[model samples]
Target chain A: MNPANGGWLIALTLVAAMLLGVVHLPETWPGWLGWLRPNWLILVLFFWVIEVPHRVGLIAMWITGLFVDVLYADPVGLNGLILASVSYLGWRFFERLRMYSVLQQCGILFLLVLGAEVLSVMVLGLGSERPWSWHVLVSALVTMLVWPLMFLLLLRLRTGLRVE
Target chain B: MSALLITLESSTRLLDPLRSFIGSLVSPIYVVAESPYLLTNAVGDVLATREQLQQKNRDLERRVLELSQISQQYVALKAENDRLRELLGSQGRLPYEVLIAELVGVIPDPTTFQIIIDKGADAGLSVGQAVLDAEGLFGQVVEVNRFTSRVLLLTDRDHAVPVRINRNGVRSIAGGTGDMGSLVLENVAISADIVEGDRVETSGLGGRFPPGYPVGIVASVVVEPTSAFAEVLVRPSALLDRSRHVLVIFTPQPQIESNDANTDGVVDLDQGEAAPATNGVENAQAGAT
Candidate 1:
């Protein structure tokens, strides 16, 4: 496929991922399960940043973070700052990240996601007086666990569709 | 860090318009995302057995009959109450106008207990309006966008409501503990007339919430001998996690009358009317029990 079509396809996948991230689970789902939900938006952004660092840069990630901020009714620019920093790190190490094994990548992504969670907590703490809890780390771990699956799935799509 | 802090602190003015624009833009995405769950629920209803459907219909009819009977008595009581208020030189309780909205999205982060509804300022919603489910008081609107608004749930740590014990009319402040399914009432004296199983309702002291809506039930009351205050835990009356349909209460703004009798510089006429109504309720409660 042409680079233009490939870019469009990647954008489409990212949009779908974001929708999945925002969709509400059934009310009957237990509260603990909510804490375990992986950060799908971060996972998708990380994937694209690793694969096509030139295409999905800090500006795109920041804008996507703003979208998430609106979706969650959080203070705008909070997620933008978090996502932009993380994306910058991802882009800086994109080549190195691609060379690492999936397991090593998961370890590094864990720290990245953890950093995002901590930064979000700090920012939200500054903006509002919400009590911080340990459950925030749970989502980071869940995101780490889901990384390999997302990586493999996106890799297959990119190869089969001949993206870029 | 200082710049970020300033930006974060001033976001309500600087970022609200942009946020509202983004909110309007993503509203379609929210609707599309919610469609699958809605479709599944619809399919489940369509596939229910005939006997199950019949039972549900019968149950609804019985509930409707019961409510209609209670409403008849309520109308008469309201008229009597109005007459009494007129005699006492107080304005009658203003009726609430409500708009039903569907829960579009919920903040999944456990720390922030908030939900977004499908209505906004365009629909006459304003900040501080009360939100409710079928059971009781749920929360209040803290932010209003163009096409949607966010409700800060009663379970969020930042939320606090002035509540009164239903049995003795003793007042207390119920604050969210940031935990699921619980609130904490602070500063109740050890000898206070509070107990487990006591119903709590909004006291309307701050005028943000309408008075008398059920807020929660006292789950546990712990009195430590060493401590000056008792710790009271409350579980909200509304199904905070489950209800998809909610009502946004629209309280009518007091009319601005320029008549000679109103020449006195009263800033808020509603506040003046509310005080006597509150006292009358307390007296009636005292008399009833």
Candidate 2:
């Protein structure tokens, strides 16, 4: 695949993930269900970084995180740090992560997203004290649960677009 | 790279402009995300029966009539107050200016209870500006970007408002409990005169929020023998979960030089020339609209 098409594909996927990240649930939906929405940005970034380590690297992940931070109105660079760290780890262990089954990868994703969630909360606490909630932990679990579907979806997109 | 950006963002506002710039770049994401909700609303509006539309129109007309009557009374009272102040050689109070803002988004995080409104720094909305629904005080702006801003709702766990009982002037602090339906009064003396059904309004003690806007009503008061403070709960008057339109209020009298310049130009023309009574024509248009 030409480099230009792959790059646009990456951006399109990132924007899609960002939209899902901040999407509001209908009012009839229970409030607690909102926390169950998986952290889509991390999942997509991890998939791209693991599959095409050369194309999606630390800086790309960081920039996408910056966009997410702005979209969520979170402390700027907070999600960038999370994405950078996750991408760095993915880049380091791409071979191992690739060899693992989808279920095993979910375990890894659970841990990765959990760390990202906890780190964001702690950094936010640095400015002002905000109490911790189960959402931080629960969201990671839900993201882990969501990985197989995300993995297959992106897998098809990568192959369908021939995004090498 | 992330560490440096975070450090600069927190230590100084060196990254504030960059933040707003990024916010503007990504502004379309808000529209894309909200398309489903917007389409649903549009469909509902279009699908409403003729009778339903007429009923809604009649209800709105009646509300406007009631509000105009109250405003007329208020204008007369304001004129009398101005005259009395003039006789006493006192300064006149400026009328608070407000801009109508529409809700753009709700924070996805349920526990935080925040929202994004269409008005932002570009609209001169600043952090701590009071936001109100038609019924009562709703919240305050927390973060301002280029075209949108975030508001922490009155029921956010971290939000609190200094309020006074409208029945008597006894003041207390109403703190949110992360519930959409209620707020808790902090450190109310057990002997506090607050009672069930007492009307609560902003006291202007801290001055972040202006005085006299209705905040809530004291729903229940429980006095305990072991505790020094009584537990009082308030039901907010604003529909925190439902209101789509809000008003952001700020004192414009001293803030914008350009607006003052325009007003001055208008006044000069009115005083100096036969300007065809443009001011009266503008006022009539404003009233008709």
Candidate 3:
């Protein structure tokens, strides 16, 4: 497996995640249901950071976060900062995180997603009039629920595609 | 952390070019993502029965005729109104240049009320421009990139509109309650003449939102003798949560000469005259009843 092929695979996966993040739901869907959509980008970033710690670095995560910031119309560098921290944590504990059971990993992922959400709300809420609500927690939960599936799927892609 | 905070606080001008550049780059991702929904809708339209298509066409034709007749009368009234305004030495409201935009994406977080529209600076959209749908005032552009703009909806807790009751023209401030369907009218004295079901319209006082667009309707009025102000809940007229198409209002920059006078007049009329006049009328009506 060559580095070039693996890099392209990673890039393609990230692009797919970005598209998922921006996809619009049907107009008829209730607003409350929107909260259930997981943070697709974060899940993918976490997966890559854990599987290929040497390949996926903090700079890459931060740049992807900037793209997410632009996509979300949030203050530039907000997501970058959040993702930088999350990727740093993942990089630091990749060995242990890899050895943990899927359920334990899910617990940690839940905390990571929740922490990101709280930080985002605190930062973005400073200038805006948005009130902090419990509904944001639903997304963290949804992200946690989606983690195992994302992990397994990415694992297969890496192995099957002979991605180094 | 401090560096991040500083970046967040700075005027986005430092990052505007970069943001816009990347925004244009990723705009197609949004378009492609939205294709499935659009395709389904197109398919649905195509699969509709011939009878259903005929019925819709006939209904639309009848509506067009009815609207044209009303528009014919409105043109005459508009001329008279312009003449009266000139006679009174007051500036007429500027005609707005409106551009239609489609909702490409919505912020999924329920706590935030913002939407990304398909039009941006390329389409002459600028921050703080008022947005509306077919029903009424929707929101305002808070950020404009190259190919997209972000709108903070009327129900965002941080958004407020200067509005007046259509019935009595009593001015008040309507603030978002973080609820999609409602706005709260603030600072109205319990004794004020506002009643349930009164229509709220933009007062055009803030210079941000143009005057006279429908905002909401009073859903409930709760007056507690213990409280200084009445709690007036208003239901937004626009489908803030549903509408896919919105109009960005390009109100020409108002000239200073008449704007200052107009502001002073609004302050006087709203504070000194309109309140007392409405109070008097309400009292007289109460006596008659």
Which candidate gets the maximum lDDT versus the true structure? 2
Per-residue CA lDDT of model 3 for B78-164, tens digit only, reads 899999999999987667889999987776556768888899888988767789999999988876778888788888876788899
Q: Is the docking of candidate 3 incorrect, acceptable, medium or high quality?
A: acceptable
Report the TM-score of candidate 3, chain A only: 0.95
The candidate that wins on TM-score is 1
Clashing pairs in 3: none
Write down the TM-score for model 2.
Answer: 0.87
Q: Which of the two candidates, 2 or 3, achieves a greater lDDT against the reference?
A: 2
- Stretches off by above 4 angstroms in model 3 are B5-13, B255-289
Q: In order, how many clashes per candidate? A: 0, 0, 0
Alpha carbon deviation, residue B184, candidate 2 (Å): 2.2
Pairs clashing in candidate 1? none
lDDT of each: 0.78, 0.80, 0.79
Model 1 chain A lDDT-worst window of ten: A1-10
TM-score of model 3 vs. true structure: 0.88
Reference-based lDDT, residue B51, model 2: 98
Q: What TM-score did chain B of candidate 1 earn? A: 0.85
Q: What is the lDDT for B195 in model 1?
A: 89
Off by over 4 Å in 1: B1-12, B256-289
